[model samples]
Target: MSPRILILGGGYVGMYTALRLQRKLRRGEARVTVIDADSYMTYQPFLPEAAAGNLEPRHVVVPLRRVLNRCTLLSGWATAIDVAGRTVDFSPHRGESRKIEYDVLIVAPGSVSRTLPIPGLAECGIGFKTVEEAIHLRNHVLAQLELAASTTDQAVRREALTFVFVGAGFAGVEALAELEDMAHDALRYYPELKADELRWYLIEATDRILPEVGPEMGRWTLEQLRARGIDVRLGTKLESAKDGRIVLDDGTEFDAATLVWTAGVKPHPIVRHSDLPIDAKGRVKATSRLTVEGVDGVFAAGDCAAVPDLTNPGEYTAPNAQHAVRQTKVLADNVLAHLRGGKMGDYRHAYAGSVASLGLHKGVAQIYGRRLRGPLAWFVHRTYHLSRVPTVNRKVRVLIDWTLALFFRREIVALGALSEPRREFELATRDK
Candidate 1:
């Protein structure tokens, strides 16, 4: 019988692994099955653009059913994995649960937003991780603008136009910058509104922003944001957010209609279901070869696996797309070696530089020990990520979207009505 390879999560790790295996593995050599909460995988790098309405949301995602033709796609969650019993229990949204025995398992469920227990955070804050969240943010922002424009109350208008983003990481910065640019461009439509009336604040607990680009670049990013009139509060944390009112640790308080949280991420909670060896951070422990340490016929990588960094020695690889994409090749190769009774290969690569977009036609990048900024870095950022946006079909679609963007104005038309379209229908037929 052929080996059964079971993979969890359809994020970058799971999707890339399945992509490689389907091409390399021969017919019936191994039966590959992937189970994920969602049937499609989102290319998260374009999420900010999607939120700003610079790119269509659908173009930024890859549909698994259309791409993974050779593998069994299960749309559900992995409730538990009895590693010793060699069976994985799967639960669907609207169906009975079942256990599927597997020869090998790959736990790559990825990460979730690392949030704090600060008051009102759960009720007020929205994360900038997935496509749904991105679109919702866009709608919410536009709704705030509409509210501010239509209202006569100065206090209410001020609160509606105020935007606060906690955590100065890549997601927070990019999303804030992109949306700010969009909102600034949108002010012309509102005759009563002035661009200066919209307030943008980037609050970070640490002293610097864009930690991936190093301190100097982080300072440069700070200067750029400040030049654009953003109120950047460094070394400040969110103390409370009770009732959608934000209170900062440094004795600042305000009511903001939108609160975006993009601080960090913790490994997927699904790892606890299995007896997989985990570290203190709740990440599955794995060796440099992408093999789950001390676990036979099982492997892990990407955000969920704490794969040791051979280049850095003492530390594990950072949870980034660069590492995850490169690790997939090594994982796929090692899996082939395991099937053929050969030794597995080690996964090692030095950290490549990082690039960040600071609004349209503005960016900062550190590449090969060299720093780049402005339009050149922004073009490079778009080009590099566009090259890595999955299949050629998606590549073409995204490229087309970009090309059209140059000739057309951004669509600030928010479809808030889409959320509750049934409201109108229900009211219309209530008497009947």
Candidate 2:
């Protein structure tokens, strides 16, 4: 009988692994089954651009069924993995729980936003992890502008216009920068609102921002943002966010309708529930060869796996798209080699560097120890990511989006009603 290969999650690792296996595996060699909550794999690096209306949201996500046509795509949640029994417990979108047996298992559910116990954070703050979140945030930001423009109360207008973002990582920085640019561009249409009135604050617990781009670039980014009148409070932490009131450890207090949290990410919670051996950080313990440590016929990579950094012996590779995308190639190759009784190679790629877009025509990059900033870095950021974002179909679509953007003004219209399409219907049906 052919081996049944079960893959958990359809994000960067899981989707790429399945894609590679489908192409490389001989007919009847293995049955690849990929299970994920969503049927589409989001190219998360393009999320900020999508939110800023630079790229269509649909283009940023690859349909699993479309891409992994050869693999059995299961739209469900992997509740538990009994590694000892070689069976996984899964629950579909609307069905009874089922157990699936597999000869080879790959766990790559990826990471979730790492949040802290700050007061009222769960209710008050929003995360920047998914495409849905990105779209909602964009709509919410634009809606806030509308609210500020038409509101008569000074406090209400002030609260509506103030946007606060926590964390200085890529997600937080990029999202904040892009959204701010979009909002700034939008101000030309709002005769009642001024650009200066649209207050933007960036709160980072650390002293620096965009640490991936080196200290010099980080400092330069800080200066650039400051020059644009963005309030960047470094070495600050959010003490509380109760009732939409942002209280920082630095003694700053503000009532803002918007708060974006992109502090960091932890290994997906499924990792802890699984029978796989996990490191102290709650990530699957992975060998340098991309196989789970102390386990046979099992592999792990991406954010969910603590893959040892061969270049830096005491540390694991940083959880980022750069490493995740590269690791997938090695992971797929190793999995195939293992199945065929061939020698598996170690996953070793020295940290190439990082690229980050600060907004339209603004960015920073550090590649191969060389640093770049401004429009050149921004171009480099787009070019590098454009090459990396999976599929020729998406690459062409994204290029067209960019090409069209050159001559077109940004579409700033907010569609807040999309989230509550039934609200009007329900209200109309009710007795007035």
Candidate 3:
């Protein structure tokens, strides 16, 4: 029987591994199967552009079936993994739960939004991880302007136009900057809605934002955001968000219809269901080679695995797309080496500098020991991510979007109905 290689989660690691295996291994050598909850691989870096109306939402995600044509694609979620038995249990989109035995396993379930027990968060706030959220935010931001324009009441206008973001990392800063740019531009269409009337607040518990980009870049980012009339509150945390009323730990309070939570992400809880060894943070204990500790034929990578950072002592790799993509290459090569009776190689990558976009045509970056700010850094930010976005088709589409944005205005249509597909059904089924 051919070796059955099962990869869980179709994120960076899963998709790259399956693609590499399909290319490296000859036909009938191994049966590769990839399972994921979603049918698309989201290029997360482009999410801010998608939210800001700079790029189309559909272009930010690649359909898995179209990309991974060689492998068996299962659109489902893996519920449990029995490492000892070499089998995986998953719940498909339809039908009964099923189990599939595998000769080798790759666990890369990735991460989810790490939320807190703060009041009204789950009921009121939105996460900024998925493509759906980006699209929804784009529409919602535009819709807020519409609401502000239609309402004569000052309080109603204030509430509708207020936007709050929690966390100052890349996700929060970029998202806030992009949306603020979009909202400011969108106000031109609404005579009643002034750019100054829209309240934009960025709350962070830490003293600085964009820690990955270092202190100097972070300070520059703060100044840039403040210059744009953003209320950037550092060393402050969100205490509560009940009924869209935000309460900061510093005793500041305000009502905002738009609250985005981009604080951080935690490992997928599905890692706990597996018998594989896990670290204190609940991530799979993986060696430098990306193999599960004490478990042969099982490998792990991406956000779900605690793969050691060889360059840094007493530290594992940080969960970022930069490391994830680089690690995927090593993991793929090692997986191929293992199959061909060749020696597996270790994963060792030096930390690369970080860059961030502060709205369109504005950016900060420190790369290869060189510091850059303003348009140069912003151009570098776009150039680097565009290069990394994957596939020639997507690259061309994204480039075209960028080229068109130079001459044309951004589209700021809010389709809030995208969030709730069964809104009418829910309303009709409601008890009167």
In candidate 3, where is summed lDDT lowest over 10 consecutive residues? 186-195
Candidate 2 residue lDDT tens string, 197-216: 98999999999999988889
**TM-score of candidate 3 relative to the true fold:** 0.97
Q: lDDT of each prediction vs. the true structure?
A: 0.91, 0.93, 0.90
Structure candidate 2, residue pairs in collision:
none
TM-score of each: 0.98, 0.99, 0.97
When 2 and 3 are scored with TM-score, the better candidate is 2
Q: Candidate 1: lDDT over CA atoms?
A: 0.91
Native-to-model Cα distance after best TM-score fit, residue 312 in candidate 2, in Å = 1.5
Q: Give the Cα-based TM-score of candidate 2 against the true structure.
A: 0.99
Q: Which ranges of candidate 3 are over 4 A from the true structure? A: 421-432
Ranking by lDDT: 2, 1, 3
